[model samples]
Structures are given as C-alpha cells and as structure tokens.
Target: MDDDTILVTGATGGLGREVLARARRTGRPVRALTRRAALPDDPGVAWFTGDLTTGASLDAAFAGAGTVIHCASDTRHPKHDIPGFHHLLAAAERGGTRHIVNISIVGVDRIPYGYYRVKLEGERLLAASGTGWTNLRATQFPELLDKAFTVLSRLPVMLVPAGALCQPVDRGEVADRLVELALEAPAGRVPDLAGPVVQRLDRMAAGWLRAAGKRRPVLAVPLPGKLGAGLRAGALTSPARAVGRRTWEQYLAGKASR
Candidate 1:
C-alpha cells in the first residue's frame, strides 16, 4: 500500500477536493484526475488529464495507480453515468487496480428521481466490476440542501414536502470516510452514513433562512405518489446509523461565520 498511488476522480468538485486534501495530509502519493491539461506547481500532487466520457487518455491516469476513489458523476446527462463508469471500470481492470471506492447517495434504491436512477445503475456496475471494490451510501449534504432552498426561494413562498424527514451530513465528514475505505481492504458495501440528527424539511429550511438573513415563509405541501410517501416516512434517514458529527444548524452557523 505504501508504494501504490491513490488516484481520485472529480478533483475539482466539493467532495473530491476534500478527499484530495485529506489524502495529501496522510503523505501517501496522490494523483488527481481532471480534464485540464495543466497541473499545479505542487510537486506532491500528480495531475492526470483525461476524458471519462470516451475513455480516451485515461491510460495515463490509471497507470501506476493501485487504489481509486471514484467521486465523479454525470448528473446533467444521466445516461452518461453508466457508460462513463464502464469506461473507468475497463481501464481499472486493465491497469490491475486493486481497490475502487465509490460514493453514492442514500435512497437511490427507493427514490424515483432521474439522477437517482442513474446512481442505482452505477451500484450494479460496480458490484460486477470483477475488481476489489467498496461502495458507500451517504445521506444528503448541507450544500445540496442549501442549493435546493436557494432555488425554491425564487418563489414568493418556498414550498416544501410536508412531513418529509432529512438527515444532512457534512461533505468533509463523508470525504474522511471515503479515504478510510480506500486505505483498508476492499469492502463490498459498507454501512450507510447519516447525519447526527434527523430533522423535518421545514425545520432545515427555517434554519437556512435565518442564517442567510432571509424572511421568506416556508409552506409545507404534501408530496404525492411513492416518492413523497417514502420521504414523509423518513426513507432517506438512518436514525440508528447517524455516523456524521456535524448537524445542519452547525453547518449554517459555520457558513454564516465565513
């Protein structure tokens, strides 16, 4: 393990950046896969330029890398998630990759959201990748909640799914767990990671409004069909498996201070 280089995809994204930073502190050789041709001046960081969509130029990225932390996803083009991930799997196999750590969202199996469907397919692909792998399902992040509220705030009144429960974990905490998985022997599927507290969607929205200094009133509307029912039933949260330490209110306070 000491000689193997840890390669991370989606190096520019929020979670991936946290993974890269934590990996660097461990003093293990780290390589960040990106689309840009130019890399930074940091001697410790090795940058690989490649396109996962076509799998072209990935040879250089997979070369000499024994462990891979896959944090990249194609949300805009859901169709691309599986094909691109297949490209990664093929390259990893050819490169003699020992372990692959994948990040996934909780409730992908039950949620009917388009992007979640793609994530579910990804899980299938990894299970049969024929390589050592570990997949982790983490609850929603504070950033995602913040973004959702920001978009809904466009309306005069923010409409939330009534009785919907949420467990929002910090991105940095999830990153730490991914790195821990990458360091250990491959685990097929780990336990779910969740936030410290399970709160109602309306409560989270109120906290966000207070932090952002907005007075927009939040209205809870009963969501329809299975998706709404699952959320209202607390399908996204694991009260017994609250592995993360940071709470949503703490996250809001942290953002406000910054």
Candidate 2:
C-alpha cells in the first residue's frame, strides 16, 4: 500500500520483462501482472495472475499500487485492445492508482492499420481516465523487423513493401525509457523514441539473411491503399527523434553469435 509500489502489466512480454528487471534494480516493491499463474521464482518480483481483456484478478493486482505500468496489449486479437485498456483504466481509478504508463506505437494516427487504430483509442481512453497517466509511443522493435525476414528467408526471394521505411528501435532500451517514465511525474504522451537509423524494409530484411548465413534476393512489391502510401512516405518513423542505440544489423549480428 506504499506509494513506492509499482505494478507492471504484461510482465512476461519482451518489453515488460525488461521493465521488471530494471524495476527490480531500483530496490522498490514490484508487482508483475500476467494472465498465467506460472512465473519464475524471482524473489525480487511478486507475480499476480490477471487478464486485462477479461478484467480478472485486476482488483488484487491493482490494490495498494501507486504506479501501474500498463503494457498489456492485444495486437493480433485487435478486438481486445480497447476493452482491455478500458478495464485497466477502470481498475486503476477504483484502486486509487497514482500513475499509469502506457506503451504505444508511432504513426497510430497516420497509419490506417486496425491494430494501430485500437492503440490510438487506448491512448484516448487513458488520457480521459480519472487517474494520472503517461503514454510513450515508440517505433517498431528490431525483432519485429527480423520476423518479416525470418519467415521470408524460407523462400528463394524476400518480398518487401515498396518504398516502405522503418526505424526499428531496441525493446531493451525502450524498457529503460518506460521505467524512467514510471519513476518520474506523469507526463502525458512524451516525445517518441525511434531507431538510430532509417532504412528501407528490403535492405533491413536482406541484412537479416546475411547474418543468418543465408542468401536471398529481395524484391520490393508495391502495396495498395493509404497504408502503403503512408509507409512509403515514412509515416511510421520519427526521423528527428531517432534516439535508439541498436540497429537491425547489430541486432542480427548479436543473434547470429548466440
């Protein structure tokens, strides 16, 4: 019930795990909220079973927490995005939570993607919620960019979106920024974080192949609709805010070594 207690949702996810690790380093009370009961035996972290979409066990998860790091999201099941966040906001308000830090993606407003639309609404709901809040939108992660190529590497040729550009940031560093926000005063929608470099998707995918000890030809395919045009025009990137340290090639090289 202390003001120092920090509750983190989606604690098992990529960025959420990093946040928990960093939060543990602070020596403050930390609560990790996840849908599963099975969690590692980390003495420094207290695990709470909960589901953001179903709003189950959130009362106990949010109880006595001053700050709630709302990282739980459903991009694949886009339908759950809005309702899940709504449930979080409601729980935070009722539980008397002080601050809520939300993780969002860049170009949600500009991009016509369905998941992005849901995320945008989540941001809106959080802003209007009766609790303190901070929303941080970041560029795509290096692993996400790697996935497209990983699957395409199976074929003789890698197909990429025509003229699309990506500034893939590192999730580790992003977790750093999120924890920083959680510690500081609630700032609504801070400056976005992007990758150190901006390059075409085809080039990034090709680098993945080289790092994986494979060879494949990259072909750029033109995509239709506003989604394609926005990507081609760099709508998904924050060029001026390219503050991330890791690059796609560096991530790939490190992966290859592992």
TM-score for each prediction?
0.96, 0.97
Clashes of each: 0, 0
Model 1: per-residue Cα lDDT over 1-70, one tens digit each: 3337899998877898899998888778899988667766767788888878888889877876899999
Error of 2 at 50 (Å): 0.7
What is the C-alpha lDDT profile of model 2 across 148-242, one tens digit per residue? 67887787888889899999999999999999999999999999999999999888877887888898888999999999999999998999999
Those runs of model 2 whose alpha carbons end farther than 4 Å from true positions after fitting are none
What CA RMSD would candidate 2 show?
1.0
Model 2 collision count: 0
Which residue pairs clash in candidate 1?
Answer: none
The alpha-carbon deviation from the true structure for residue 148 of candidate 2, after best TM-score superposition, in angstroms, is 1.9
